[model samples]
Target: MTVLQSFPIPRPTTNPYLIMLGEALRRTPGVTVLNFSWKTALFGRYDVYHSHWPEILVGGRTPLRRLTRQALALMILIRLRLTRRPIVRTVHNVERPDGLTARESALLDVIDRQTTMRIRLNSTTRLPDGERFKTIPHGHYRDWFARYEPQEMQDGQIGYVGLIRRYKGVEGLVSAFRETEGRREGLTLRLGGNPSTSQLAASVASLADGDRRIELHLAYLSDAELVEIVTSSELVVLPYRFMHNSGGALAALSLNRPVLVPDNEVNRKLSDEVGSGWVHLFDGELTAESIITALDAAAVRADRPDLSARDWDRAGIEHADVYRAAIDAGHRR
Candidate 1:
């Protein structure tokens, strides 16, 4: 079967998940994959259109451009529908990364209605439409990222890495860190990620205001820098208000660092499934004290689960199943 990705990538440079999955897919026997281009999509023949981030087509820096892109994407959707090809959207987040706007939400509703299949990273991921969605666990980064020896929990380092945005609960992290600073001696907080927007950068910077114990590197860090942060840290926090699944947590665990996350259903499922000393869940209003308690659990993690089941090879096989299922469903339609 031939599969066309919704977005074009000649090579996967950034997202390690994509890199790993693409490599696995390429290795899969009797499977052909094509990088997506609008013109190629129009003329190219394929059995399935698999999209990890369909929002990328519509999302932009400005509202006007975003709307314009959405209009063009709608036309593309219609073209795909006319071609009678199956569309598979991989649900990375239950909501948009930048927060779902009303217009964006409506656009997603259309996509949901038109979609033949929706692939979620985990079983606990909620679906807007239940008829077509299924879960395939996210592959770990152990094979992709540079392997580093795990460091001891010197000074109780608590780290957060990924794009900094309001939805990420950075304010809560800063406040919680400040509140815990007094009781936990030598506990340091380090946050590294490019802020989603310029205004978000300025606002979040103020939260760190001259705190010696807290270090803020609010820019995109290289892989080595990311490794340094994860390797040195005692534990990492997702700190998302709500998330379907997190590659960041997997990255931390791949480097042998435990993770703390909010007690949402998807997160809880990840905790139970990953079941290494990997996850420490927090309940009802995460405050400084709660974070401290979670850290204490991380401090004494003697056994961490080896998440070998979530490798790229397994993900690729699972994804193949989804694509074939979509093809079958399209035939039925």
Candidate 2:
């Protein structure tokens, strides 16, 4: 009943989903969780190999370099397939395709066809080569919710968390916060999270330079710091330009803090299902003035209980089941 689990460990990045998966595996009898590495994992002996987010491995590299790496990884995966060892891949972000060259895409296509099981967070993701794909909702760190103490509703503090990417709409938040100038009572925007790129950092800093109220921590945040920021904030807003599923939104809800997100089809579905009125639906007209108006309104209704107790526990258990199903299916084949 021994199982080998391999997942990427990115530095200065705390993947709560990966950590939760490892914890779930540890709880299961006769499962061995192994750290994922290129050279080691390819050669390691195991009953089952579960890889997370194959898209990321193909992304963020130069075209030539990405092609080369994909070829190498594909070769290893092909060899593993020939051995008939069960391999399962979990697709974390199916909302966006990996920036891959034609060759890399074809290579991944091959692997996807051969892989025994494909796990996805959302049920809507299409399977590659008509392979077996299962739906698994992402999990949150259970301890993150325990550390939160609801702060007194103060007038000026707003919090935003998650990887500070341009698409995340941090600039929109900054613009909206600026519009609140002189109109609201001491409005301050406290941004805490990892910035994916230097361009994003510079962009945020440039906006925050003159404004003392806008405090941006352009560094990797620990779990404790995350708890502190989320719990202390008056309201948490996820002003994403386009978001598939927000880990930030779930984290905020786990802390009993309300979240304000754009009213997209995906977000609206999640908000409605969770019964959390915390979501602020913004149509295509998200100007600085419009956003400020929304923020002002949210300040008053921030304490409204939007999320139901059912949605929270259901998300966690669904994730646990995905892991178990992957393992069980491996044994079956």
Instruction: Report the number of the highest-TM-score candidate.
Output: 1
Q: Give a tens-digit lDDT track for model 2, residues 1-333.
A: 334555655344657766666666666554556667677556776666676666655554576877667766776677666666666777766644645567657766766665677777665566667576767666644454565554555555788877788778888788778867777766678898778888888888887778888888888787777777877776687888877767888787677666777776667666665554455667663455554555566554444444453243454454445556655665565
TM-score of each: 0.88, 0.79
Clashing pairs in 2: 276-306
- Which lDDT tens digits does candidate 1 get at residues 51-133? 78867876889988898788877877787777778889888766665586887778776777778988878887677645777
The runs of at least 3 residues in candidate 2 whose Cα sits more than 4 Å from the true structure, single-residue gaps closed, are 8-12, 38-40, 56-72, 95-99, 124-131, 145-153, 288-333
Looking at candidate 2, the ten consecutive residues that score lowest on lDDT are: 303-312
| lDDT for 203 (candidate 1) | 79
* Reference-based TM-score, model 2: 0.79
